[model samples]
Target: MTAIIHDAVIVTGDDEDTVHYGASIAIDGTRIAAIGPNAELQQRYPSAERIDGRGRMVMPGFANTHTHLTMTLARGVFEDLSPPHKPPFSGGLSPIPLPDMTQDERRVMAQLGALECLRSGVTFMLEDSSDIDDYAETLAGSGLRFLFGERAYDRTGTAIGDPAPFQLDRAMGEKHMATIERTFAKWNGKADGRIRIAISAWAPDMCSPELLKDLSALQSKLGTWITIHLNQIWGEVAAVQAHRNRLPTEYLADLGFLNDKVICAHCRCMDPREEKLLGDAKVIVAFNAAIAARRGLSPRIDSLERQGCTITMGSDNMAEDMVEVMRTGLFMERVRREDGRNPTPEQALRWASRNGYKAFGMADGGWLAAGNKADLIVIDTQRAHLVPMLRAVSNFVHNGQARDVQSVMVDGRWLMRDGKVLTMDEPAIVAQAQEVANKAWSRQFKKRFDKPPAGFSPAALP
Candidate 1:
């Protein structure tokens, strides 16, 4: 298959961060055949189908390094349920309980999240969750490049951020390892090599020392990447210190688990020494900016990058808008550094796209170049917010919205075109997801609380 997206603005999220005007992309099969002037590409691939890009801008799709597709069900409610940062910390992100659902309902929510990702021009994603295989079918059919970081942990009586005493269950830990292996065996190379499964340690405080060592060894044996939640909050930091007698980063480093292949999410509540060690290990930091903002926290992205760590971006749980993630990351870092122009929009675009592609081991994608993977998006440039594009990339970085993305392509295939997703039934998924969420939450919230939050509305959410 061959096609030409002719006459568009090309923002190459590459190391050079090049932006080419009035250019076209020639895609042959699953790779980009060329990138050149409109006349040149049209003359080169005469027989190819031409996609009119007259008022559109073409750029690499986003790489969401961490997210929970199934957890999308926690959207409106969980954003406000962030855990406490002060003393006497609990292990999990929030003490609030989420409604339980059947596997079918979970699948619907995952599909809805996938719909959101496609709509937002997220071509690549890394989903960190337990029993990820339950939703592997949903992801496999979504036409998105993704890494399923299957979670494994052995701690009983608590979750990640709890300061409670560690209670290790070797049998349960063994079961999780077995599940990881089974999932890998079943789905690692599926989806024409688009879907990959990676090992994940839940968090520093949740996994025992022996469990961490075993998971690390397993990762090496499988020749795959690993991800973890590290320093997500002060409570989490306290929990790790109380249990392992060391900081979170120190615990991972002491077990020889910190490496270039590891993707650490939420390094917000870190000690200076921990930051230095993470930089020394050269791990890729998954700056989950939106969730951090929701939790009133932000990572030291600039310091981590300067210290030798590769910085990338992720949407994290309860959200799927990579556009928001990228923009929020830029704003957060600027405020953290107190510099108006320190981490430029170009830098944020690099972290969100190119850096993330490399982190997921898809080095050929996430950038526009000949012979690279044909994973890109087309945005409508004629919108009111996108007018007067004197500085194309700058304007996009500062002002682009997810709704502006009208088409998405992965490996030369149209996952979405003209604002319509091709791989899934969008309307059915949306309606079914809403139905499931409403029924589930209505039942759970009623069972738990006597009344809704102060200004309760009978019609807000029945």
Candidate 2:
């Protein structure tokens, strides 16, 4: 598969933040073969398929460091339901529980999430869940790169943020281990190295010390990556403190689970000492900025980066819009710093693209280079909101919408072209997923609420 997109603006999200105008990128097989002026690329690749790029800006696609793909089912319901940050913590992120779905239903919802990711120009994802195999095959067929982390934990009788007494569930932990191993065997290094696998510790409050140590050992033994939810909420922090008499980061540190290969998601509610501890470990922080804003929290991205942490961006739960994540991270950091010019758009794009791709162990991706992987997106820059494009990178970063994404390519294959999805049936996926979510919510509300509350109207379910 050889192709050339000629006469486009290229935003190479490299360390130098180079932007090339009137340039062309030549893709050969699964790698970028050449980048040069339009005539030069045309002359070089004479037999390649040509794509007009006069009104588009081509850049690296996003690599989301952390997200739960099936959480797309809770989109309209969960964003408005956040747990209290004070004492007497709630069990999980929301007081209202989500309706459970069958494996097939979950597969549909995961497809919906994948649709959103492709539409929003996400090429890579790290899915954190206890059971990824349920929808693993379905997502693999989507042609996007992924790093799957199958979770294992020992504590029972409580959800993520509950302060209940820890009950060791050794059998359940072993069950998770078996599933993790099975999933790894089935999918790790699959798709010709387009997909990778990882070991996941659910959370410090949810996993016992023995289980954490075991997970760490397994990660080392397998020579794989590790990921965890670290200090996501104050309730989880309180729960960890009560359970171990130490902060969540301290617990992981004591168990020797903190390392450079570990991708820590949501360090929003950590103490300054704990933050410093994570930075000292040189961990990568998946700064899920949009979800943090929904919960009215934010991570200390600057301080963490300064203290030696590699900062990356994630869409997290209930969303898959990396454009929103990148822009929101920029706005949040600017407001936090009270200085608008500190972390530039280039830096934010690096966190969203380059840093995340590096964290996913794809150093050859998320940037524009002659020999790098051909993973990139084309944005339609002829829209009204994108005009006056003196600063192309800043214009796209600050004001770009997901709808601006016109084409997406991963491994030199087009997953989306000119607003049409190529991998999955978008209409069928969306229709089935809408029914799945509607029925799930209807069932939950019917189970919990006897009558509709004021200002609440349930959807008419099939």
Candidate 3:
């Protein structure tokens, strides 16, 4: 089947990167066939089905390099927990006692999160899964392209409410490995080669050195990608330095785990030496700006980028809004550099889109060009913030929101059209997810506390 998107502003992913004023994109099967002026493409593919892209800007959808799909329930649930806002895993008081949610609850929440990603112009994601078996069905049904990172941990007594203690044991670790292998066999190259599995290790503190080494070896054996959080907080930095007598990056590098296939999230505390190590190892650094800002941590984006390090963007905690991430990224860098013009919108877009694909060892998607994957999003140009657009891409990075996204296509299929999802029933998914999360949070909070805090009424959630 052939389809041509006509009379649109095409942002071709080229080094010169000139926007085609009235171009058309022809898709043959799942790959882009041609990108040129509308007249040229129309004459080229005369009989193809046409999509009128008038009054719209078509660009490659953003790649969310790191995300916890099931963490959607935690959104806005723990905002004011403590001073500096203690995370659920921390020993400090938690705003809401995150209850033990079942696999079914996670699936419902994950489905809602997936739909949110599509609506926000995110076509690809590197999603971390707790139990691959439980959510495999939900992931399979999600039309969005993603990489499932099977998470593992072996250390115990590290933090409060940590899942690592429950996941410890060499036998249990091997069982998790078996699940990953089975998942890869069944899902890798499935859904028309849009989904693949990666081996994920929890942070160094949560996982022992032996577990990290074993997981690294397993990743190599399976030819899969590896992901881990590195230097997310000062406390983690202190612990790693105290235990290993080196920085977090140095410890990971010493394990022979630093490589191009490895993605290290939140290198906010990395210095020049560690930055160079990451650059030399060709490691992909996920700069999760939204979460970093919320936690009062920020990465040195320009410094790392200039040092030959490749950086990508991730929403991290379920702030699934890409525009928020981009804006936060721009502001974070500007604030750090004390130079408002240091990181431009173009650079921010590159991190959010192209760099994310490069991080995952996929080169075909993340840009609008011939022969790339047909994963692109369309933004309505008529919105108030989008009006008077002298520069289209800049306006998109700076002013556009998720609601501005009109349609989205992944693997030549419309996952969302006219702001409505086609593959999943979004309203039903959201309702079920809200119900389960509310019940879970309420029960957990009640059990953890004798009396609720002042002004905290046990009201029903939306």
Per-model TM values vs. the true structure: 0.97, 0.97, 0.92
> Please, what are the lDDT tens digits per residue for candidate 1 over residues 169-265?
9899999999999999999989999998899899988898999999999998899999999998898889988987989999899999999999999
Q: Model 2, 111-205: lDDT tens per residue? A: 99888989999999998886788888888899999999998888888788888788889999989888888888889999878878898888999
| RMSD (Å) per prediction | 1.5, 1.5, 3.1
lDDT by residue (376-459, candidate 3, tens digit) is: 898898888898867887888888888998989888888888878888888899889888777876776667753444554455
Clashing pairs in 1: 90-161, 90-162, 91-161, 91-162
Identify the leading candidate in terms of lDDT: 2
**In angstroms, what RMSD does candidate 3 have relative to the true structure?**
3.1
Worst 10 residues of 1 by lDDT: 451-460
What are the lDDT scores of the predictions, listed in order?
0.88, 0.89, 0.78
Cα misplacement distance, residue 253 of candidate 1 (Å): 0.6
